[model samples]
Target: MTGQVSVAGLGPGHEAQITPEVSAALAGATDVLGYIPYVARIAPRPGLVLHASDNREELGRARAALDLAAQGRRVVIVSSGDPGVFAMASALFEAVEATGRTDIDIRILPGITAMLAAAARAGAPLGHDFCAINLSDNLKPAALVEHRLRHAARGDFAMAFYNPRSASRPDGFGRALQILREECGPGRLVVFARAVSTPEERLAITTLAEARPEMADMRTVVLVGNSHTRRVGGWVYAPRSATVSAPASDPEGDA
Candidate 1:
């Protein structure tokens, strides 16, 4: 039997949100590796081996899975959301490149990401042009994050944020709110969707002026509307059509 590696997503939180393709992959996996929380989602079986590691061990985990596959094990690497969207798929590819293992058979299975799930729950805040940004500075610099935030805001694009805040870096999201308020103004809509599709799920809609940093945490996915986003009845949405004057080009050479 040929060794294979399947990097699969398990969806946001609910089992129902997981795609049939990913579930099927999990069922046939001889070995599974992932973050501790994600690996816990898989059921134990007679021939299956589960490897759970800390969240910071992504690169190591990816290499381990590849090694297992090289040994002819049907390995599956699981992530909470879409593997391609801020998850294991990228890490797996990076490991493949570092190890010079181009011959490995790898499959990237997609699932509903937290951003899209939150958008659906909020009545389509991302109905128009949008961009998703991860605010954590663990892998990238903070200056780059603010630069992207300003550009995205200036372009009148709706925005989705993942890993918005944590205890150690609580001040970052507060600074982000300040930047958004300056670029998009006080009246723009902001949605805070936490733990979507789960029992503890929460959805809050407010204007940028009223938004506070304390409203968000690690589990929360923050959404900012373009200038055209508005509320219809009890739901918030960004209209399909928008009419806005073009923003001025950056003075620092960025267009």
Candidate 2:
């Protein structure tokens, strides 16, 4: 398979956060494919073709990258954060699996995801056990989101949430905040890291009682600390270790 398809992460809005491996993939790519804003990060050069599409077209975009590779084009699918983390890598693999394509070289180049970036900016709230949850209900049922939130809270796991709000689903985040308040209580720390690493980046650390739903938009990544999470100075973090406790049962009865 001379033709290759590389799924690369551009990191969270900053060129500095992009990994060297992803940079190499982009350099060698003949065709770059991704969402409009992600693709716009790449500079136009001779022999490189840019294919920008709208959001919510992951399958189509993945297939297009695969088809281009089949035609001997060195294609790279760019994702804003790590392609593996709720990004193009999964969609690309899904397309490859469905097609049973064994004739093309496929590579997944990882990048620093938004959660990690946001966590770093917020002083390591994910220093201990953590779970990353995508709060959007576009692909999954809304009930599952609440279920996962409850489980994560019951597990006492630090959580990083993505896609907290969007124009079509503004109420979902508010409901999520409500579920968190019910489970984690008012004193739990929440960090709203908006546009991390970008010029418009803003970080707000507050307790659940003080955290308003309006603080988070689509660009924001919200982090909720476990029961033991606390602030040292200006930073919030969960310690590396925690005392063992009996596992909490799910509030919802098993069917």
Candidate 3:
């Protein structure tokens, strides 16, 4: 019998958010592997082995799951949110490519990603076209992050930011706020959503003038509205149409 590898998403910290396909994969998996907290979300049972590792070891974890599949073990690699959205899917494929393994069957199961989940909880702040940006500079250069932010702002696209801040890069979020304030101005709406679907979830909505960089943490996903975003009663939303007028672009067209 041939072995298989399934890269599955756990969604945003809630069992209810996990897809039926992912649940089925977990139930049939002989081995489950993921970051420590994500692996802990899976229940232990007979004939199943769970391998949990630290956060920075994504490539190692991906390679291990591929190896287990090659050894005829049905393996599931778990990631929070969708595996393809800044998660394990790319790493898995990279490992598979490096190993040149074609005999093992590989599958990716999608789940509710953090930005969409956060937007839902905040009343559709991403209703218009938007760009999802990873604010973490661990894998990319900080200059590129700044460059993308300027372009996203210039285009007047709503923005969703992942991994907004961490202890290692304490001032990154602060600088991001400065750029947004300069480009989008002080009135644009910003939403800070922490741990969506979990008991500890918290949501804050404010304008650029009132938004503080300290509101975001590694656990938080920040959303910045396009020029047309606004608050209706207690909820915030961007209109579905881009016909709404946006702020004037800088002279060079890249703010």
RMSD of each: 1.7, 2.0, 1.8
Error of 1 at 209 (Å): 0.5
Q: What does the lDDT read for residue 129 in candidate 3?
A: 94
The lDDT for every candidate, in the order shown, is 0.92, 0.92, 0.92
Model 1 poorest ten-residue lDDT run: 246-255
Query: How many angstroms is residue 154 displaced in model 1 relative to the true structure, after the best TM-score fit?
Result: 0.7
lDDT per residue as tens, model 2, 178-232: 9988888899999999999999999999999999889999999999999889999
Candidate 3 residues 24-123, lDDT tens each?
A: 9999999999999999999999999999999989989988998898889999999999999989999998888888886789999999999999999999
lDDT of 1 by residue, 1-255 (tens): 458999998999999999999999998999999999899999999999999999989999999988999899999999988999888999999999999988889999999999999999999899999999999999999999999999899888999999999988989999999999888889999999999999999999999999999999999999999988999987999888998645544444573
User: Whole-model lDDT, candidate 1?
Assistant: 0.92
lDDT of 3 at 141: 94
What residue runs in model 1 are displaced by over 4 Å at the alpha carbon?
Answer: 246-255
Better of 1 and 2 by lDDT: 1
Count clashes in each candidate, considering only residues at least 3 apart in sequence or on different chains: 0, 0, 0
Error of 1 at 84 (Å): 0.7
